[model samples]
Target: MTVQFYINKFQALKPDKSSGHAKPHKVCLLLAVIEQIEQGFITTNKVIYNDNLKSRFTYYFEQLQQGNDKDTPYLPFYHLQTSGFWHLDVKPEYQEEFSALKAASNSNISRYVSFAYFDEELFDYLKSPATRHALKDALIHNLDSLEVQYQRWALSIGKSEKTVKNYVGALKGSISNWLYDAGISKENVLSIGSYAQYSVVASKALQIEEFRAKNTTGNGMYSAALKSYQSFLADVTQVNVKDDIDKILNDENTTATEKSTLVNTRIGQGAFRDKLIQYWQGCALTRYNKMQFLIASHIKPWASADDKERLDPNNGLLLLANIDKAFDLGYITFTEKGKIVISPYLDDYQVLGISKNMGVNLNQQHQDYLAYHREVTFKK
Candidate 1:
């Protein structure tokens, strides 16, 4: 449906001329939209004649433009209504007027026909990266835009195509939107390997395909990649497990004292918060003093605790959720000596907004739990 549909439909493009060259202008415009889709640029289907389309059309036009031919962007852009792959969208008031001129020649068609769309099947087929590339190959192979040598050259190299497309997408497409001052290149990011290997692609493959995490928990590559990407960004690994204490507390076999101290509503989660509110007025890591934004995250972890340890206010550290999630997931841990110990797995701690000076004031009792977490749970 993908390759055959494009070839058959595109090869049938009726040239306005009775003589020399058959300009593949409609195909070129279709290629422009396909390029936009592949780069994650266009969200919706309507190809509005806005700045985006104008710029894309110009880029493709320059690449495909040939000898003695003037820049006629509006030519096939309007005339493609005859082709099965595209149709014009005019205003309701212009419906009668539009239908009358639907079969007009290049010069007769108005530039005011500002919107066009791909047929539904053609649009859906172009959504896949691999399929999109194959279709482009078919277009150029049958009736090319550029010279055959340049087309073959583009198809031959891994580095050159990768590098050029990376630069183009970054400068003018969805990558620009994605990177938005993030100060990282898609080339460098793609070279980062499995961890951050484009979350969007991994997400679609994993969600629909039921991909599993390699050497880790959860289903799909996402479980691993997302955590890895986050770790890559934040410089520490994270484990997204359900709250184990909640599971233990719900067990009927669990003793009342154990259950009592683990329930969030039953003086467990709130009581720890109350104690922390009294003891430390700010987060240990950033000294961020907003109580509303702080969490009473555990040092020893609740599932590992006995009743006394579970209820002990001193066992918890007041950290912001940003820091707390990191602490909770073992990206960052504290020493018995109260110094912040970031995991070695992290690439750059600064990227995570974690200051080098992060620490907590600890007593003799808090030191014991910190030691256990540092040894057993810390990503180290």
Candidate 2:
């Protein structure tokens, strides 16, 4: 769709304002336009009408010339395209400028874009810290299958093969521990099959009324599955490792000595060790070459967990002294799906400084651990 058409549609969608401008309405219209474009419901060519171009331009021009809200200005067609109108390719400088505009507009626009109206509540569910973590766990627990699912999703989204491969590989390594959570069971979930089918099943499972009307046991299972998937998404977006670890450490079940021993013993053992080797074969966190200096740090507190649970590989990460200390001490942690979660408890400068020093980036391999850490360790 052409930019002018989008503007008209946006204006039409907005509630009629006789006097002052409707900031909220305008923001909602912008969000709707972007969302429609993202879902392929609208295109650049269609946005600009071939015959009514003049009329369209005239309307936007009139709005700009007579609009009450001077702060929220409308861009001309050239400005919109040059400013990287959503999907259209633009020069690097224009892209940067567009990014700035988007950033500025995001908060206002996102407020009006309700997730309740979407086909699936997946994106909305992902907004939660716990749900994101659970989703990460689900993805990691079903890593091999999830990778294929991700590829399928990527393809459906029109991502290139190389991009799909990279995303799948990165997510696999990062969220390895997601499947190991206490409540999740292998029987309830399916992996190697079609993602579209899985999504359908998942959606069906989430239909509370239908599920309840069917078998009670089946309903429970579906509820559990939905919860697990929601948690996985939460892990992806919001799980925090350090806070969870701190909670574990402070739990009445654990002692200071046990905490220390837990830290010392599992720093390089079994699954944890293997995960560390897989994630940072050469210690990406510390850049330390010596194997002795590298250690697999647990996202959850070992003292708070059973021996078997502590040994689970999904609980660990390979790190150097500073990074390990930060993770262990709750100064730093990762989101459920390997995204870095800087503690608000720390100074902004400290967080930024540490992040710069560590050079950490979210990868698929860390998703499992990141989810666990977010669920069990992150503060909030």
Candidate 3:
């Protein structure tokens, strides 16, 4: 349970080598747990198999995955019990049934296990940054050696080391250009102050003419690299909001009129939409006076908001259907100055009638909600 004891355990993980390459699944899961701990998402030793942890595991899996390796986080979550430090807490009544099973499948694990946890000592050691770093480095050292071997193999096959180095730098350079184009400074999250900003920034970076012009390769290598990076980060950082309306609709005690009002507010069909219409006097972006063509969109997503934020006129925008969809999906956002900041990932903006010059009419009341949109909702 000491630091070195845990370090040795992490380094000596028994990954499947039947295919001649380590599966990387367990190591990736451990790395994801460490990341979640650092991010304050996994506060206690009990590891709930939630979307955040699953997404983080998938992120690391993508990073280290070799040929033919499939993403199956549930495998490690259950099988890690054999590794001594990890343990699974099963449902009380299902304990005997779970014990009788020889193999773990996703559905069975979900039904049987309440959560997983580490040994008390190991969990305490993981709370230390130095301990976490040492343990992670031990796990990653194997991956590093594999990369070195791959490089040597490439050289033996007549590919120069310089070509290999440039191939590696392609993704970094592409990502740098994306950050620059999105007005985010190198090494800083800028005004938004979160990784959530990367969602929209990655999107806008793809749309930048200079980015496309410089990074274009005949086979789409650079673009693919950018997308790969984007995908990994988005998976790690994106917040999954459960639909609040669904929960309310399922409550049998709730009255029909209340359900109707909530549903109407959600779809911009009720008083909330009426308020947005009156405030904007038309489309918030285009000032298009036609009322029927606009949708009332929440700046801070409905599921993540309270009742006040959900119905606040200042928290809403009356946008055209296309613009509403883009904004809802985080492909389009507005600056504090109200100018349009489109995601590079948004394809065919010209066809959709969206432009860089578009802006929304804003007041002081809207600033807080807009800030939430830029930080958490925007695709940057």
- In terms of lDDT, the best-performing candidate is 3
- Model 1, 297-369: lDDT tens digits are 7788766777678778878888865567567667788777778888765434554467667688888988788
- Candidate 3 per-residue lDDT over residues 47-115, each given as its tens digit: 988755766676567556667888888999988887999999999999999999988787888889999
Question: How well does candidate 2 match the true structure in TM-score terms?
Answer: 0.27
Q: For this target, which candidate reaches the highest TM-score against the unseen true structure?
A: 3
Q: Candidate 2, which segments miss by more than 4 Å at Cα?
A: 1-264, 267-275, 284-288, 348-353, 356-369
Cα RMSDs of all predictions? 19.3, 21.0, 14.5
Models 1 onward score TM values of 0.38, 0.27, 0.45
Per-residue lDDT over 182-272 for candidate 2, one digit per residue giving the tens place of the 0 to 100 score: 2222333434232333444445444434445432644343343343343333222222333444454566877875664444344243345
Ranking by lDDT: 3, 1, 2
